[model samples]
Target: MAAFTASVIPIVSFILITLAVRCHATALIEGLYCGKKNCYDVLGINRDSDKQDIAKSYRRLARKYHPDVSKESDPEEKFREVANAYEILKDDESRRDYDYMLDHPEEFYGHYYRYYRRRMSPQVDVRVVIAGVITFVSIFQYMHGWWRYNDAMKYLLNEPKYRTMAVSKANELGLLSKIERRKRPKEDVKADEEAVLRKMLEENVDVRGGYSRPSLWDVMWVRVVLLPYTLVLYVIWWFKWQWTYFVMKQEYTEEDRHYLTRKALKLTTVQWESIGREKQSELIEKELWVNDNFQAYTNQQQEEMKAKYAESAKYRRYRRYMKNHKPGPIVDSD
Candidate 1:
């Protein structure tokens, strides 16, 4: 049984790695792009079309080929495509990628897949890894810290109020430092003292996604003390193992591709409108009637929004925690 468990993991990891490669990192782009050459390609606009001309062309085509009024054999299909095209040409990132593709048109299908993720992803991944490491190390450190806290805890334990107060202080310091998020619902935020604190503590509960163990424990067998170390080592192994597996199993299905294409198109439209607005804004600020700021501002806003959303998962978790935890503790001096 020990042999089986020992053999299973690496074997599974190997298989997962193979699968990741097969999937072609679909997470990067499986559902994050439109295939049209550019926003212009989507709307059937010519390369020579100016900004106004492009807009005019889009409006005209959108109206003439609208799915609602058109009765051609593939009218709806054609109209949808037209709409999809227009939407993409109108957005910033989609349009930019489309433009980049135009310039780097030689990029093979494989290279094109990278469009699914941004360069900042690596930084984010590193941050998360660092956070996990910090959490694990601190946990073990506290385990060792246990010896020192023995006396302090005994003193504080006699005063239930102090113990409770200490927990509250830990909770608050944890929050103020932004160590983690509150785990309460918005409705529960307004609740009484105990209820709120309880909710907040709930958020800090470590949510491990699979049967992931620690990383510090990776070592040759026969040592009981190494078992705990195995947990830490397991963490590091699991992460690399998971990454390798994911990379091996990366794949994008037809439907996933379709979703990405549609989303990219819509994003493109929003980007274009944003670009136009920034240009107009720039023109406003300038004594001269120039719209040079159009591109810069559009790019800036898209970047900002993308960044905000990129870290949104963490933000939401923290917000929930804050809303749940009560501010202070109730102490009874007996």
Candidate 2:
């Protein structure tokens, strides 16, 4: 008798729990979809309806409820409901989920899972979207780079110093001609002159830094495509670096020495190039290629900077202000 009572208690608890879960799932379904109406009912179809029947019903209902065709007060809202119902019922997986929800309303978690999964799923392929985005970004980057380069060229062409040099070079190359200028239209002549200037700038002017011309290889898509190759090269470089510095203790080549010197000066390739050839030659003459010499050079530069700053007008003004404002006892003039 005692054993039977214990078993009966568990069975009663199970039944109560099942009833509660079913009640919750039904409430959730009621809230999720078109109020108390089922998706099939929204599409005017039965549970046993086939895809063809479902599609047919959806098309009919959709057209009937369409805002343009219907004279109903809220055709737009009705159209949305019809479309939503059709969207769920049109897919086999979604339809199966809906059927399962109807059959086993006690499975509240499963119902929620299926509903969200369908809702959150993307309509387009993720890979295609990613590729499209990369392509667009690459194109924008390439165009922007060219725009900057052109702006730099235009600035150089307008500069008196660079223009003089460009004009001289263009004349030497037979690009600028008085006869051609006289014969051509004003617009044509101006275009020809600008073209000549640009050509000369391209050949003579070392347009470096951020204003350098764009390259296809520098684009985002190209960079992404070459990522694997870049990784391979990096690995090889790492091994080579380890071998050179640790195992072989190889002597630095001229290029390597120059690179080290630039590194010591904390200068990028663009910055080093902008410092001018004469200045570079002077730095090289100081034997900055050697670590000890580079350190000494750095110290000398710091001292020079300190001296220059001390001689500056701002520093002099600051010193004068500090001298006048020195902390001392205030004298009573009154």
Candidate 3:
């Protein structure tokens, strides 16, 4: 009875394995470009044929069926069939998949996956694509930065405040002579004036934050190229931070204090700069660089905001509405 049971188990396992193989093969055959015809039969090659043998056979078949060269009645269709067979068998990976499909002709999904994967796979090298993308992004970023800088310059040129200052500076430098202005065409005179204003802005004005001059280092390609150096610097900074804050427990430096103050105010460098130098000086004068002072300042501001909100009619109306209305699901009626 024990022997019989063991024999029966082996037979059951064999039958299950055979069924799985058949299912896999069926799936692959369904996805073949040549329909139900075997690729090996199409290529006139045996199942055990090597790459060289397959290539040789393909060459002969291709030449015989080629529409341009062959005298065959259905040369186009015959050439296509030959090309399709060669395409499947040319690559080692694809050939292996084809061989698997032939061996296990029952798996429907596996064949579809194999077909789609081959069809969808990129022909270009991934690294080349990545490099092209980085280059494009860097160029775009650099161009965009310059565009914004130009817009800011245009604004400054148009504004009376800055325009008057620039005109004065140009006059002091003797760039806008009355004689030259009179002799030249009005268009030329206007151009010269614009040039002078641009020069004055470039020399005197210190543009900061987003409107600041674009640098190669800010572009994606440059950043990617310098990533290793940046990583090294980051590691050193981490070590220094650990030593300063944990090991030494030292007080913050002037730069550190400024950074912390900016963080406390929840301001980006651009936003902080937009506050103007006078406002910045006022904040610094209040000793906000000190952690305790910063905390107290924040608390005071929060309390002031709360008092203002309580007094506001808009806030009162919003609060009253929310309190009076209880959220509930909407009922549908026919």
lDDT of 1 at 47: 57
Q: For every model shown, what is its TM-score relative to the native structure?
A: 0.25, 0.67, 0.70
Higher-scoring candidate on TM-score, 2 or 3: 3
Candidate 3, residues 1-334, lDDT tens digits: the string is 9999999999999999998866654643544756677788899998889989999999999999988899999999989888999898888888888787666665657777887888899988899999999989989999999999999999999999999999899889887774366566899878877988888988898888888889887899988989999999999998998899779999777667656667768899788778887777677666775688988888998999999999999999999998999677888976
lDDT of 1 by residue, 1-334 (tens): 9999999999999999987665433322323344432346566676566567767887887777777876667777767667766665665555666556554544547335645554234635686786677677666654554544444434444566654664576567664344223886755443334343433443443222221222334222223446677788989977865665466665544444433333433445334344465553443443221234545645777999988976899887877887897567878988
- Residue pairs with backbone overlap in model 2: none
As a whole number from 0 to 100, the lDDT of residue 289 in candidate 1 is 15
Which candidate leads in TM-score? 3
Cα TM-score of candidate 2: 0.67
lDDT (CA) per prediction: 0.54, 0.84, 0.83
Clashes of each: 49, 0, 13
Best by lDDT: 2
Evaluate model 1: give its TM-score. Answer: 0.25
Q: What is the lDDT of residue 327 in candidate 1?
A: 69
Q: Which runs in model 2 stand beyond 4 Å of their true positions?
A: 1-28, 34-53, 56-83, 92-136, 182-187, 260-265, 276-299, 311-318, 325-334
